[model samples]
Target: MPPVWDPAEAPVGDVGAALLMVDARIKEIHEPEDESEDGAEAERGELNRLFVASAGAEGVQELLDGTCTLLYMFMQWLRRTHEHGDKDVIEYVVPPLVATLRMMPRSVRPQTVPTMVALVVAAGTQVSPNGWRSQYGDWTPEEMNALEATVFLVAEHINRIAGDHNFAVRMIAETLTRVETDGD
Candidate 1:
């Protein structure tokens, strides 16, 4: 199921109702026709692969801040380079990844949403970086440690595939020029 994330698009009338709508999206994504445990597990594995973004996002500290800045910056980059692609790529990986965001404390959920959206989008395309906004409060050290990556596994993946050694490094300029700094 596709993730319905934008609260503005919610049909509800109040903030509380909108929160319900937002939370409901997590439930909705997990409700596939097959309710077996195996089905759910498959969804989770796929979701993990999606967030990895070929970025080896498993223990790099550069993107960590009071909030998940890696996620925020990546999403900002996606909006500029692949808005429609974001829509296309996100649906397939919604279950656990969306669930992950839903699992976060409500205090920081709003701040981390773009990171979720960005990861969902970055799953398919080679969408990448540019951006400046990041939140600096309302985060736990454990949470920050849980999610951070400094290596671009995809850059190597693409380079190896394309046989263009310089292709990955060249992307930095393209991404920077197109992406905007978010969360200022």
Candidate 2:
């Protein structure tokens, strides 16, 4: 994989705008195999649907690759934002990844784990040494607990949507290791 794009060097000014740019780039690279679906549906599902109509490992690889690109883009967009400040972005990012984990057969599970790791690493970088504190850094214990509950709202999301038991266990273990090790 290419070196992770550094947000400071090329900050993504607006998340949606960057994604639209990526959409165009993806189109430039990948011609859709199926044109039966209308442009609107195809446009929105471009990232996740790459594999459904194509044949062989190349198709599945493209689907996972698209998702990983999305993950990288979201993380770059999240740079320097306070914890949970990127909540909206996370909501947009995690579901597709979770769905990919559950919906794709185990054939891609090994490859997909790296994509999950990228998310964990991105979220980890968003925090301060003080840890997810508000701008003022004066949050109370209760407030801190509440924030912690939601700090990893994405993690909680995956936990609830564990459609594949073994895959889910591996993901849970990876997330725990990243959290415990301060994202290395």
Candidate 3:
């Protein structure tokens, strides 16, 4: 619950490097043939360690933002890649992430919605069973539907936190209007 970083002042290079390191670790964990099947606990531990290490860059706003984005991507990956019914790793990781998000400074908080959407969409596409393109004879209807639903849910949660509760609704309405007018 402590402030992750003070947006006003923090060493940009050091914090950025720390966040990148954590991201690389996350990538390693997700790599095929990299982590052992029985190492789920170890994977979660490593993620936790990275999370804490990133927190040490406290006061660096972008570092915190990058960390949160990476963690969310990790969650989306965890849900898709793992077949285990037991979600102990997710259960262990998300609360702290949520806490970290809530602790973000107002200056950086507005960016959360877009960041969540981007990461969620990226995660969904990468983890899609068939492929990223549902319209290209790749993804099944069910997979497309699931991906859409996941993106919608993540956006809604982010909008709620970012105080833009009607964001998606407004975006849909705007898009519909644009389509109706043929870009006029």
Candidate 4:
């Protein structure tokens, strides 16, 4: 069973403030050791802790919902670029986004699944052009399969949430279409 979050104990405003404080502390902690390998490792650990804490806080689902909205906007941006033949946009964005997605924990991945799927769909569409393909070879078939699987898993989780069924289904379909198109 999932742990019940008590907003009475920690209100959403309090949680947001706590997250901001934690972020500030993390930055301060890492600034001095930015040049050292140990500092880098420590910074990573702090970041992981922050994310876990944020995800566990009361009203985190609301935060996730808001994040999903922002991600959707990013997806629209990607789609618009594709329609305009602006492949150069991805050259500046995809690598970092991909790296971040790859490093995310499976638990967290499910939380952001819709956003990830949207990103994949946008990327697949952009990559369909000959110029895009020449720059970044056809994405590996296995990668698309893995993303599809992830989308389904995330959809299952989102289905369990109270008000997210429609968004989940839409994201799942979008992701599946991209996976199929890329595989072809």
After best superposition, candidate 1 residue 98: deviation in angstroms?
A: 6.2
Residue 56, candidate 1: how far off, in angstroms? 25
For candidate 1, what is the total of clashing residue pairs? 6
Give Cα distance to truth, residue 147, candidate 1, Å. 2.3
Q: Candidate 2's C-alpha lDDT?
A: 0.38
lDDT of 1 by residue, 1-184 (tens): 1222332221221222222222233234444455555666567557545644653433222222212222323334434444555553244334434555556554234455565455335433333211221223333433332232211222333334447644433454344445535423
Order the candidates by TM-score, highest first — what do you get? 4, 1, 2, 3
The regions of model 2 sitting more than 4 angstroms off are 1-71, 78-88, 110-184
| TM-score, per-candidate, Cα-based | 0.27, 0.26, 0.25, 0.31
Show model 1 residue runs off by greater than 4 Å: 1-69, 79-82, 85-89, 96-138, 149-184
Provide the overall lDDT of each model, using Cα atoms, as 2-decimal numbers: 0.36, 0.38, 0.40, 0.40
Tens-digit lDDT string for candidate 2 (13-70) = 2223223334443344245556565685456457434534553454433332333333
Residue 179 lDDT (model 2): 61
Supply candidate 4's per-residue lDDT for 134. 24
Q: In terms of lDDT, which candidate is stronger, 2 or 4? A: 4
Q: List the residue pairs that clash in candidate 2.
A: none
Error of 4 at 183 (Å): 44
Count of steric clashes across candidates, in order: 6, 0, 2, 0
Candidate 1 weakest ten by summed lDDT = 7-16
Error of 2 at 92 (Å): 4.0
Clashing pairs in 1: 54-154, 131-180, 131-181, 132-181, 132-182, 133-182
